[model samples]
Target: MDLINNLALGLGVAFTAQNLLYAFVGCLLGTVIGVLPGLGPLATIAMLLPVTYSLPPLAALIMLAGIYYGAQYGGSTTAILVNLPGESSSVVTALDGYQMARKGRAGPALAAAGIGSFIAGTVGTLVLAAFAVPLTAVAFKFGPAEYFSLMVLGLIGAVVLSSGSLLKAIAMIVLGLLIGTIGTDVNSGMERYSFGLPDLSDGIGFLVIAMGIFGFGDIIKNLSDKGTKRELFTKKVENLMPTRKDFKLMLPAVLRGTTLGSMLGILPGGGALLSAFAAYSVEKKIRLQPGEVPLGQGNIRGVAGPESANNAGAQTSFIPMLTLGIPANAVMALMVGAMTIHNIQPGPQVMTSNPELFWGLIASMWIGNLMLVVLNLPLVGIWIKLLTVPYRWLFPAIVMFCAIGVYSTNNNTFDIWMLGLFGIIGYGFVKLGCEPAPLLLGLILGPMMEENLRRALLLSRGEWSVIITRPLSAVLLAAALVMLVVVLLPSVKRKREEAFVED
Candidate 1:
C-alpha cells in the first residue's frame, strides 16, 4: 500500500511536463553517447552535470539518472553492430554480441539485450522502491563506527570484485586515497596537499578526473589502436524479436543475472560492472549439451544475462548512496555532489526530511526506464546510421564536447588543465596495466573513511583498539582481511584473473 502511494506521488512529480521532457531528452542523449565509440555514461553524465544546475533538483537528477542507465541499453547496440563496447559494462556484451551478429543473429541478440534490459531495469526500480525506505530506516541506527565499517566493506567489495590484478587494484585504491587527500583538512582548516595552489585547496574535481580517466583515456586507447578497423555489420536484421527457443535459454540467465545484480548493486564500488561480468560467468557455468553455443561464442544468453544484470545493478546501486550517503560508483558520487549543492543531506534523514526527493527519484527511474525502452528499440535504424559517421569527424566533435563540458562546470581553466594532467595519468594507467575503478572507489570513500576513523579515535580517547573492539567494525575489518587471504590462494588468484579483463 505504501509502495503504491509513494509511487503514485512519484509519478505525479515525474510525469509533469518539464520532468517528462527532460527524461526523454536524457534517454535520447544517453543512447547517442552510448552508440558512439569510446564514450560511456559516466563521461556523458559528467559532461551534462553543469546543465542540471538550472533545473529543479528532482528534475535534474531524474534526467541525469536516465542518462546513466540508458547508456547501458545503448551500449549493446555498438557491441552487436561493431565489436566495440560503447560502455565498460558492455565489453562482455561485445564478446558474444558481435559474434552473434557475425552469425547473422544480430537482430535476436539486440532484441534480447533490449528486452532483458527493460525487464531488469523495471524490476530493479521496483526493488529500489521496496528497499529504499527500510534501508533508510536501518541507516538511522548507524553511528560513525557503523558508517565507517560499511564504507570499509564497500571498498573491500569493490577491490575484490574488480576485474584486474589484486595487487594493482589495491595500489590504485591507495593512490586514489592519496589523491583524495589533496584538498584542505576540514577538521583542522589546514591545507594538506595543496602545495600553495588555490585550485588544489578544493581538491581534484571528481568530474575532471572521471572524464580524464574513463572518457579521454578510452578515446586515446582507441586512437592508439590504429589498425583496429571497426567492422560494422550491415547484415539484414530479420526477425527483430527473440525466438521461443531464445526465450527459453535467456529466461534463466536473466533471472540469475537479475538476482546477482540486485544483491551486488547494494554494495559500493563497481557493482554494476561487477554484476555484469558475474552474470556472464554464471551463464557460462550453467552447463549445456554438446554443440550448444559456448559462453563467448554468440550465445543469446550472453546478451540477455549481462544486459539484465547491468541494468538491475545500475538501478540498485543508488541504495547505498541514498540511504547511507556512500556512493557505489562515480555517477552516484556525482549525484551526491549534486545533492550537496542543493543543500540536501543524503543520509538516512533524507527519507524522512526529504521524502519528496527520495520518492520522486525512485518513481522517476521507472518513468526513465520506460522512456528509454520506448526511445531506443524502434530507433535501432537511426542508431546504426550513426555508426556510419567516420571516426575522423566524430573524434574531434567528441573532444570538443568534452572540452566544453569540463570548462562549463566551474568556468575555470584550472579544471581543463587538471583534466589534461589526469588524462596523461589515465593513459599511464592503461600502459602500466592498472585498473582505475578501484582507484575511483578509494577516491570517493577516502575522505569519509578518514573522518570516521578520526571521529572514532576521538570518541575513544585515542584508543586505536576501538576499531577492533566494535563488533561491526571488527567484522568488516575481518572480512577485508579474509578477502585478501582468499584472493592470495593459488586457485582463487587464477580464478580472479580469469574473471577480470587484463589491465
Candidate 2:
C-alpha cells in the first residue's frame, strides 16, 4: 500500500507537462545518438550537462536518465540493420543480430531486441523502486567509519572488475585522488595545490573534466581513426512482429537475462556493458533446441538475451547512486555531479527530504521505456536514415557543442584551456590502453573518503583502530580485502581478463 501511494505520488509528478516534454526530447535524442555509431550516452550527457543548468532538477534528471536507457533501445537498431554497434553494450548484439539480418530475418531480430528491452527495462525499474528505500534505510545506519570503509570497498571493487591491468587501474585511481586534492581545503581555509592561479581555487569543475575527457576526447579519438564503410543489411524492414516460435525462445531468455542483469547492475563496476557480456556468456552455456540456430548464427535468443540484460543493467545501475551516494559506474559518477550542481546531496536523506524527486525520477523511467518501444518499432526507417550522415559532419558539430558547453559554464578562457589540456590527456589515456572510468570514480569519491576518514579519527580520539573495531566498518573492509585477494589469485585474474575480451 505504501509502495502504491509512493508510485501514485511519483506518477503525479512525472505526468506534469514540462516533465513529459523533457522526457520525450531526451528519448528522441537518445535514440538518434544510439543510432549513430561511435557516440555513447556518457559523451552525449557530458556535452549536455551545461544545458541542464536552465532546467528544473527533476526535469533535468529525467531527461538525462532517459538518454541513458533509451540508448539501449536504439543501439540494437544499428546492430541488426548494420554490423556496427552504436553503444559499447550493443557490441554483443551485433554478433547474432547482424547474422540474423544477413539471413533476411532482420525484422524479427529487431522486434525481439525491442520487446526484450522494454520488458527488461520495466522489470529493472520495479526492482529499483522496491530496493531503493530499503537500501536507503540501511544506509542511514552508516557512520563515518562505515561510510569510509564502504568507499574503500567500492574502489577495490572497481579495481577488481575493471577491464585492464590492476596496476594501471590503481595508478589511475591515485592520480585522480591527487587531482582531487587541488583546491581550497575545507577545514584549513588555505590553498593546497592552487599554484597561485585563481581559476584553480575552486578545483577543477566536474563539467570541464567530463566534457573534456568524454566529449572532446572521444571526438579526437574518432577523428584519428580511418573511416570504414558501413553496409546496411536491408534498405526496407518488413514484418515488424515476431513469430510464435520467436516468442517462445526469447521469453525465457529475456527472463534469465533480466534476473542476471538486475543482480550484476547493483554491483560496483557492473553496468550495461558488463551485463551484456555476462548474459551472452550465460546464454552460450545453455543447451540449444534441436532445430534452433547456434549462438552467433542468427539466434533470436542471442538477440533477445543480451539486449534485455543490457537495458536491465542500465536501469538498475542507478540503485547505489541514488541510495548510497556511491556510483556503480562512470555514468552514475556523472549523475553525482549533476545532483551536486543542483545543490542536492545524494544518499539516504534524499528519499525523506525530497520524495517528489526520488519517486518522480523512478516513475519517469517506466514512461520512458514505453516511449522507447513506441518510437523504436514504428520509426525503424527513420533511425536507419540517420545512419547515413557522415562522421565528417557529425564530429565537427560535437566538437563545437562540447566547446560551447564548457565555455558557457563559467565564461572563462582558462576553463577552455583546461578543457584542451584534459582532452589531450584523455586521448593519451586512450593511447596508453588505460581505462578512465576508475579515475573519474576516484576523483568523485576522494574528498568524501578523506572527510569520512578524518571524522572517524576525530570521533575515536585519533585511534587508527576505529576502522577495524566497528563491526560494520570492519566487515566492509574485510570484504574489500577479500575482493583484493580473490582478484589477485592467478586463476581468477585470468578469468577476469577473459571475461572482458571484446571478441
Candidate 3:
C-alpha cells in the first residue's frame, strides 16, 4: 500500500509539464549522440553537466537519467545498421546485429532491439522500486572491509567476462589502476604523480578518458581503414514491425536478459556494458532452434538479448547510487556529483527527506522509456540512413566535436592534450584485441577501493586479517578467487572464445 501511494506520488511529480519536456529533450539528445559512433552516454553526460547547474535538481536528474538509457537504445541502432557500436554496451550487438542487417532483416533486428529494451527497462525499473528499501537496509550493514572485497569481486568479474586473453585483461586493469592513481594522494597533501603539473593535481577527467579512448580512438580506427564501405538496410525496412517468429524468439531472450542485467547491475563494477556482454555470452551458450541461424550469423536472439540486458542494466545501476550512495559506474559517479552540487546527500535518507525527488526520478524513467520507443520506432529509417553518410566527412566532424566538448569541460586545454594521448592508447588497445570496458571499470573503482581498504585497516588498528575475518568481506573475497579460477579453467576459456568471436 505504501509502495503504491509512493509510486502514485512519483507519477504525479513526473507528469509535470516541466519534467516531461526535459525528459523528452534528454531522450532526443541522447539518441542523437548514440546514433553517432564514439559519443557515448559518458561523453554526452559530461558535455551536458554544465547545463544542469541552473535547473531544478529533480528536472536535472530526470533529464540525465533519460539520456543514459536513451543512449542505450540509440546505440543498438548504430550497431545493427553500420556495424559500429555507438556505445560500449552495443559492441556485442554488432556481432550478430550487423550480420542480420547484411542478411536483409534490419527491420526485425531494430524492432527486437527496441522492443526488448522497452520490456527490460520496465522490468528493471519495477525491480528497482520493489527492492530498493531492502537493498538499502543490506547496504547499511556493509563495513569498509566488505566494500573493498566487493570491489575485488567486481574487478575479477570484469576479467572473467572480458573477451580477450586473461593476461591482457589483467594488464589493462592494472594500467587503468595506475592511471587512476595519477592525481594527488588523499591522506597526504602532496601530489603523487603530477610531475609538477598543477592540472594533474585535480586528476584526469573521466570525460577526457572517455572522449579520448572512445571518441578520438574510434575516429583513428575509422580513418585508418579507408576501404570500408557501408550498405544501407533502410530499403528493406519496409516492414517496421517484427515477424511472429521474431516475437516468439525474442520474448525469452528479453526475459533472460532482464534478469541477468538486473542482478549484475547491482554489483560494484557491473553496469550496462558488462550486462550486455554477459547476456550475449549466455544467449550464445543456450540451445538453438532447428531452423535458427547460427549464434553469430544474424540470429535474432543475439540482438534481442544484449540490447535488453544493456537497457535493464542501465536502469538498475541507479539502485546503488539511489539507495546506498555508492556509484556502480562512471555515469552514476556523475549523478553523485550532481547530487552533491545540489547540496543533497545521497543515501537512505534521500528517500525520506526527498521522497518527491526520489520517486519522481524513478517514475520519469518509465515515461522516458515510453518516449524512447515512440521516438525510435518512427526514426528507424532515418537512423539507418546515417550509415549512408561518408566516413571521411563524419570522422572530421566527430573529432572537432570531441575537441570542443573536452575543452568546454573545465575550460582546460590540458584535457584536450590528454585526449590525444588516450586516442593513440585506445587505438593500440583496439589493435591488440583488448576490450577497454574493463579498464574503465578498474579506473573508476580503484580510488574507492583504496579509500575503503585504508579505512577498514585503520578501524582494525592495522590488523591485516580483518579483511578475511569479516564474514561478508570473506565471502566476497572468496567469490573473487572462485571467479579467477573459473576464468582460468580450460572449458570456460574455450566457451568464452566462441562467445565473443563473430562470423
Cα lDDT, all candidates: 0.82, 0.91, 0.84
lDDT of 3 at 439: 74
Q: Which candidate gets the maximum TM-score versus the true structure?
A: 2
Model 1 earns a TM-score of 0.93
lDDT string, candidate 1, 1-503, tens digits: 99899888888878789888888887888888788876777767766776777788888888888888888888889888788887778888888888998888888998888888888988899888899878887888776777788788877777777777778888998998999999889899999888899988989987788878876777787688775666877654677888888998988888888888888888766557888988888888889856669878888888899999999999999988888898887678777777876778778898888788788888888888887887777777788788777777766776777788789878999998888888788888999999887777788789889998899889999998888888877887788789768878999989887876621
TM-score of each: 0.93, 0.98, 0.86
Which model, 2 or 3, shows the larger TM-score? 2
Rank candidates by TM-score, best first.
2, 1, 3
Residue range 352-392, candidate 3, lDDT tens digits = 78999999999999999999999887887777676566668
How does residue 178 of candidate 2 score in lDDT?
87
Whole-model lDDT, candidate 2?
Answer: 0.91
Q: Could you tell which candidate, 1 or 3, scores higher by lDDT?
A: 3
Worst 10 residues of 2 by lDDT: 227-236
